[model samples]
Target: MSMTLFCYLMMYCSGIVSLCLARKHIMLSLLSLEFIILSLFCIFSIIVTIMISESYMMLMFLTFSVCEGVVGLSILVMMIRSHGNDHLSSINLFLC
Candidate 1:
């Protein structure tokens, strides 16, 4: 694999590991999820470039990722407003 591809894969793996291990805070998990999304975007871009295909799909993918980020941030804001912090353990579905 190329160096760039290897770097992206490593980034993806690290994001997964961080997401799994850093469960104390919602913000950490969100950041890890974003990292994973970015790595996926990079990999997808590389594939599309290699194939010399149209870039409309990449634009769509970017749009979806941005939407996902907005939703996640909104949720985080709501959580902080309600609970006063971003701790995952502090979130109780029964209380909601």
Candidate 2:
């Protein structure tokens, strides 16, 4: 159940992809963050569950994920409002 090296590589690759793709869409920016967070949480939980059965690190990860998701969504809203639009047709200098 533990995360292996392969899982780490996969998560890294996906995070990069998410970063690239999310640049083109506001909604996707939020979604991609969620994807990255989920992958991180999953990987940590897998490794913890296998190596330290009694550790509650996974629970902390889950809590952090929720908080992050909330904060990320709020940021998305702020970004859209500040930009005065939701479309990401132009490269956002602030986000960059």
Candidate 3:
């Protein structure tokens, strides 16, 4: 279990790096964000289970994360429709 927690932590770190490096590609950045959120969910689940043994909060967090992902996807779709591309450079220029 400890090993699993360590792996999740590593994944979370890598996800952050990926998000930073893939800033130009909106889809890739969003995928990295998803990875980060999932790793966080795992870490929280393990900690909460060990400390409080209640999963209600975890479930609520999962629901919120799902809603967040949906909102992100919607925004991505709108960007694609308006810009016809998913690159940050294009978006920056469009916004300006």
- Cα lDDT tens digits for candidate 1, 65-87: 99999999999999899889998
How many residue-pair clashes does candidate 2 contain? 0
Task: List the candidates' TM-scores in order.
Answer: 0.93, 0.68, 0.92
- The lDDT values for all models are 0.94, 0.74, 0.93
Return whichever of 2 and 3 wins on lDDT.
3
Best by lDDT: 1
Candidate 2, residue 12: the lDDT equals 61
Task: For each of the candidates, give the backbone clash count.
Answer: 0, 0, 0
- Misplaced by over 4 Å in model 2 are 1-12, 88-96
Weakest 10 consecutive residues of candidate 1 by summed lDDT? 87-96
Q: Which parts of model 1 are misplaced by more than 4 Å?
A: none
Model 3 has an lDDT value of 0.93
Decide which is better by lDDT, 1 or 3: 1
Candidate 3 lDDT for residue 39: 99
